[model samples]
Target: MNAPAPLEIIAMAFSLTTLRVDGSPTPALCVDDRYWALADIAPEVLQPEPSRGLMNVFGHWEHSEPLLVAAAERLASAPPLPAPHSLEDVLTPLQYPRKLVLTGANYYDHMRGDAGHSDWDKESKAPLFFLKPPTTTLVGPGRTVRYPEQTAKLDYEIELALVIGRKARHLTLADAMDHVAGYTVAVDLSARDWQRDPRHLVKFDLFGGKVFDDSCPLGPGIVPARYVDHDDLRLRFWLNGELKQDAHTRDMIWSIPEQLVAITEHLTLEPGDIVSTGTPAGVGLATGQWMCPGDLMEAEITGLGRLTVEITK
Candidate 1:
């Protein structure tokens, strides 16, 4: 249970994450630029009540936050142990998101830039959302994303994803932020060639075009809600080390609060439910530039850190 040496520490920030070592998942607190196994730094947080790992921690977040934050703060003065595993041991911060929900076309520039919905207006429109099967779609940072055999068009959309810490429903704009657990970076991988299901005469099918194996890559780790300015942060995406998408969270067509309010009105937002804010103006669909095997993708959101995923056949 020893953590890495104290020489390398992430100054001024800490985030909670789940790591897989020896093929078993365990919760860890990352501070001072190091990942300290929770069992080593603090064992109380891992009580069986909430189950082990980050997934269940969300359900108990309100009560657990103080302990986690305090433990991270004290670790600096306490002895540091060797990191249980190297950075590659990092897994999706949320081992199992209860629901992986995302807002689509929530950015004005993204809509207009592609020339698809240039006239998209916030005052008159509602946010569009979709879901990906959590277990199959979410891969951790540095993991490999499979280029599905079904399509010729593959793309990346960098987005700032919001993690909900509290179970909420019918939330109002005024207090919506209170329910947020924290933030993380998400890469929405896409396949543009999923042609319409001709029998149904549907022009766009979310399932065919968006939902596929390894389509969503989330986390380097989750930065707590109080740790950073969620609305003003920057988002960037790179395809094979070339920056393609660059935008700010402030540019979204509808604010995060608005999206949360609308969605919560219809369904419950439970602990560990990920609500990904939409992507910005740099997807490859408009230019017909498709991704091929052996490509690499890096997605980053300021404060949350960057996650790298390799593309392979």
Candidate 2:
């Protein structure tokens, strides 16, 4: 397979009408332009169901810069995009998403203990998958990650997330990349107690624990699929400014092509569908320490940019 070009980009922005702490409408731009308003755009430009307002912004950067300027002009003239209400207020332009699929233990070193090799051939016979509800998404940067009752050990997994560009079923590896619209940073927040439990064979509590309200903090921005060399990009996570998880995309046991091919065989992935490639090791659960109320979580991928969120009760 050839490397993807950088021009096929989709860009999304984190447009804020207010500062996160005071709730006062303070205009700012984190990814692109500060004045970008989702509500002012054509619905079709932001279409394809099951889409996250913010994720869609990040994934569809092709017209984003121009769109941002147009939104600012509209805001200056019309009733004005209302002051953001917890970031969700601007989501009117993004299509609502349904399911979020994530890969587990896809990293090379993560598979070394049992798989012996860095690729799937040396790893398990099949890809490991997990799901998170769309409602779990939290768009604002400073929003709190509530520590759910009964679960004392909470961890964070930093991942590169891809949004599906079109509906695809049984897509071949050769055509898999075509279905990708763009990429963004995702933090797969987990509750270690439920995640590591051996008694529950179905992992019901795992989803409940990890996919509860405000658990998934994504964004800051989305870089178009064209901006990254997916196979060789670098990803890293920092807790309180200290580097914790670091790895290259090349280390995945099951590459994106293989995973996309496998998933399309079982599920019809639609545009705006999110597939979070698994995180590298060094998560709190694996290291024996978990995140608490005051920790700051940050992640960055080369070309895709960076995202940081402060954990709060």
The candidate that wins on TM-score is 1
Kindly list the per-residue Cα lDDT of model 2 for residues 166-259, writing each as its tens digit.
6779999789998786677778888878866667787445565567666676655555465557888788999998898888889887899899
lDDT of 1 at 98: 78
Candidate 2 runs further than 4 Å off: 1-35, 38-95, 113-124, 137-139, 201-205
Model 1 earns a TM-score of 0.91
Q: Which residue ranges in model 1 land beyond 4 Å of their true spot?
A: 1-12, 78-88, 195-200
| lDDT (0 to 1) per candidate | 0.80, 0.63
Write one digit per residue (lDDT tens) for candidate 1, span 83-131: 6465456788877877999898888788988648866677777789899
- Please report how far candidate 1 places residue 68 from its true position, in Å: 1.2
Q: State which candidate has the highest lDDT.
A: 1
- The predictions' CA RMSDs to the true structure, in order, are 4.7, 6.0
